[model samples]
Target: MKINQYIRQAQYKKGFASIILIGVIVLVALGGYFTLKAKQKSSPEQTSTTATDQKVYTISDTNKSTTNQLIAESKIIESLKTNWQSIQALIPFRPGHPGTVAWLSPYSVQFIGKNNLLVGFEDGYNPGVAVLNFNNDQFKILETFKNQAVFTFSDWQSLINKYGNSSYPVSTYTVSLLRNKQIVSFQDLINVPENIFLKNY
Candidate 1:
């Protein structure tokens, strides 16, 4: 009777040990599955964050480039103003002309380049455009379109097409220059098409 009881106790201990081992294996497998799932979910979020950071950096670089370009353009304009003042002092006046007579029309000043200015003058005899080189202190006549004709808008376009190759031609009614305080006239003006001029002057 005593031997039979010991055999039964040993069998019960063996069954309990098997149950504990199976439970430990199941827990370890579940832990590994949940850890893998977490890593997969976080990968996409990390990629999204990296892309957003790159876009922000690209925009910042573009803004900085535009700001630098604007600053450079401002400096160029200021330098042109200073050069204009020096050129104004060099214009020669006629011997008998009074101080009231302007050497060149202020309204007719046009900037062709950084150091080049196109000035118009009318002295009751000659009406023409003069090109001034600020760098070399030189001046030369560009052209005298008409003696005394009705210069319409079309005529101005023709002048630009023939000589200037300018994208923007001056308006018709705008005064070119003055002769003894009188507005210079354009007579027998030629006709030209307006389509040749560029849209953005």
Candidate 2:
């Protein structure tokens, strides 16, 4: 009777050990499953954020690859020559108007991509630049700057960054050229001391 009791006790302990092992295995499996499910749920959100962060700038509706800068500039020059009256009328401070301190004229013309003409103007005192788009038998001014806005390097950088749509950014090369021309025009006025100072009698 004592041996039989001992045998029964040993069997009971073995059965308890088996149940504990099975519970541990089940808990581990459940933890792994939940971890995998969490990763799957977060993957799409991560992908969506990446897509939004990567905004791409592109050249639109122009022969960027084939258009020569010189030839494109010529076209803008011809257009300006032919439509000088109408174009000047569209600008502020017309040459003959009262209180007009500046006479605006196209100082520099560059052919950037997207049928856009980057033009610089001088008004004797202040220099300005504009990006003109030719469409439907007319020229439209897309962007314009005058005075300190066109004079400083910081403003130039800001204009380069801000002068375009979300899809099409302005060309930095053309903006640099326009800035250089405006600076030269400004220098032409200031570099002459006689013009700025009264003549000694």
Best by TM-score: 2
List model 1 lDDT by residue over 72-171, tens digit each.
Answer: 3234334534454443345453312445343333224443344444454444554444444444334444443322222455664555455454643332
Deviating ranges (above 4 Å) for candidate 1: 1-97, 100-105, 111-141, 144-151, 166-201
Please give the lDDT score at residue 28 for candidate 1.
96
Model 1: lDDT equals 0.43
Cα lDDT listed for each candidate: 0.43, 0.50
Where does candidate 1 have its weakest 10-residue lDDT segment?
187-196
The residue pairs found clashing in candidate 2 are none
Q: Give the C-alpha miss distance for residue 50 in model 1, angstroms.
A: 42
lDDT for each residue of candidate 2 in 23-131, tens digit (9 for 90 to 100): 9999999999999997666433344433432322233346443234333444556677578567756665434445765445564554444666556665655656676
